[model samples]
Target: MPIEPQALRVLMHLVAHRGRLVGKEELLDAVWGNHFVSESAVSSQIKAIRRATGDTGQTQQVVRTVHGEGYRFVAPVQEEPDAGQPPRESSSADEDGLVSPADQDRPVVAVLPFVDLSPAARHAHVARGLTQDVIAALSKHRWLRVLTGAATARLAGHPDVVEHLREKLGVRYAVEGTIRLDGERLRVSASLTDTAAGVCLWGDHFDRTFQDLFDVLDELADMLVATVEPEVGYAERNRSSRLPRTDLGTWDLFHLGSYRFFQFTREGNGEAQRLLNRCREREPDFADAHAWWAYAVVLGMVYWDTEPTTDLLDDAIQATERALRSDDQNAVFHVLHGRVQLARREYQAALATNERAVDLNPTFATAYCGMGDSLCYEGRYSEAIAQFEHAVALGSHDPQLWAFRTYGALAFLFAHRFEEAVDWTTRAASIPNCQYWTTAHRVVALAQSGHVAQARTEVPDLLEQCPGFSVDYADHKLFYLKRTDQRELYLAGLRSAGVPE
Candidate 1:
């Protein structure tokens, strides 16, 4: 702790020169600058530097004396230029690793995957559900990006997640706790810990009747969100946006639709679409029902070029309007409407829709993706990257993997990370019933990324097969030819990428 200033400089000098053998005379010259210091002083300072840096040993030297020459700093270094890379190894092994990963552009948090503390009590389901719900709950917060469950699972344990969270999640704090059940009551206790100082910022417990599972889970989720919101420091929307509603069935239906829509197949699409439709019928003014229905339309048409109904688009517009009418603050519904508009070639309308959606729910995944799509149509690439990255943070369900890949490709293409674009688009091609939009992006990505041969060979059939043969081709242009520059860039990219004649 009392290493002199001279010793501190010496240790840093060694680490700064992680490799390359430096003579002890060089160290003295660098730190002492020709001062009349004795060789003994230099040797003593070297020892102090080594000890301070925990480089314990005569042979195991961080600063090795080259027998008659001098000392050299010895350490293997690995640093990736692309900074968003996830931690490759645990930082518990590195004494100097302390930076948390909150890239100013992307909010970050860690999900402490629920631990099955009582394998005997059979609470795995409850625990897993709680963690999942908490992630979902935290997700609704506009200011924080919760680390995906898989990323945070490596950080699990009683207080085990503390430091791991700071170093891994790059979050200032983490939400962690345990679950228990006693006869008729369900108990949950959670605390948010500040990783930097290792202190508990907040904690709460909820106890509810066995049948009150829904309410208890929601309350805990709410508490977790509200507690973290203040700490995250996000600018809030107007009071109307923050107002709570009494409606529950609509949200229930929405979650159900979300749960079922993930199969990425025809039937999964049909079931989810039907439930959302019924949801609107049961609650005529529920905007989300209509919005989701529009999304369903995209999937349904995955098998044909003709639309389900001539008024299918009109239905989406109506539902979005209804959602806004009942609660203009509902960003999700507006985003749904935007998705329809984007598909329909109404780029400006789509952009406005997503802007409002983002204003209402900054964390909304589809809203940002919609905004990205709108910008892509308009050829505004940089802004699109920022928005799409947000969509990735918010996370979409399985049905959205294709959508994700599409956005990822766009993000890379527009941002000029062309190689990455090709890689993501290639992955997207395998998605079940991948839409033309996905394939089209892949075409462009591959071409621009220097895989022009493959791009040219695959795009024509893809573009011709737009909408999986389900779109109302008469109403759908299947390509954006709004700007000559945009059209040229696209066509050139596609040609280079392998779009057929």
Candidate 2:
């Protein structure tokens, strides 16, 4: 039952003046300010508020809209006092519709409509299509608050676009791009800017054949968003690190924790958990924190080889449940739930949950990775490999690129495509901070493909990295696979590669 921030702002404004009809113009000015979204945006937020509160346009039990005017909070209400503050008398949101102080700590990004530099602006529609697609894709990330395209449409040609966006909309990051159609080829250049510093943090160009405009738009947007999301995260983590540790807010803690979580090490996982714990303590309903904590819990047990105590599993499950309870429609929550289910050896349940996640956010690479992992466990190797490929394509620059490649390697190995497994594992191991298990996959795949001597040569490096390496650990890692022969094949490869026990 997560109400959107804008909707929540409107809701608070209505409730603050309970029983009084608040005019649409007042709400627009208070909520949108100089950002200049249309009245339709206000209406949409009202609709969202009603949906969240289980009230409808027809019923209007909670928020009563005065036709062609504004809205009123007509529901029975009680004034609740803050622990140390006075009873609320005004909206907690600022004039620009930004929610409470805690919420302002979250990163806000705006994707401006891409400029069409084509002849006579012939490709303007394609430019708009790409902008909208990126906006939709970025919105899937639970950690990010993406401004609707309409909110930034008017700022497309501002002389100081970044400063204007920052001053007016409180945007931390802004994405701007230009589309140029040259003959049959389309060239799209996009950049992400840090609004505060007015620095371009990242930039890239996509050149496509421009055969099917929509298809090209989808592909380019997926590529751009996948790359930009990680850059934004990296920027946030760096920004948070520069702030005083003692003054770190909940969002800062969450970002710091997320940075550590992707390091793929036991110590990193533990540190991530500690940070996320502090984050949740500060904001008990921060669904992103809860979801990341849940994933880190499973990571400790699965990838880091920490003992999987019953209590640990329960902790992961409870965190996921809490996250979903806070925001049921979040794709990341569902993806994390799938990961938890996979850790518990609930193969079918994992697959189904991951499917739901992909349905919610098709551009979310991790959801596809979850489905791939679940499919691998179900012995549906071909399908799993396809998912991994799609995931890699969508998230080529993902911070968790190692995980996606490692999952692909496993999927390939499980399918007895040993050469492809070796190739994928090699790619994964080449990534910075990739875990020893990734190397282990390469060794097993090599041995299976009749390269036992070469595999044996790599075993020493693997043993040095993971001092307690053994066939038993391999068995523990692959326990989720339902097919006994699949597990045996993996173990036999490790055995051939000269792993102990």
Estimated TM-score per prediction? Answer: 0.45, 0.81
Cα RMSD of all models vs. native, in order, equals 24.1, 9.2
Kindly report which residue stretches of model 1 are placed more than 4 angstroms away from their true locations once superposed: 1-260, 298-310, 396-402, 411-417, 426-440, 448-450, 456-481, 484-501
lDDT of 1 by residue, 290-325 (tens): 656777776565333326454876776666666556
Clash count for candidate 1 is 16
lDDT of all predictions, in order shown?
A: 0.61, 0.82
Model 2 misplacement above 4 A: 1-102
Model 2 lDDT, residue 302, Cα: 72
TM-score of model 1 vs. true structure: 0.45
Which 10 residues in a row give candidate 2 its minimum summed lDDT? Answer: 86-95
Per-prediction backbone clash count: 16, 0
> What is candidate 2's lDDT per residue for 313-357, written digit by digit as tens?
888888887777766677888999988888888988888888998
Task: For model 2, state the Cα shift of residue 178 in Å.
Answer: 0.8
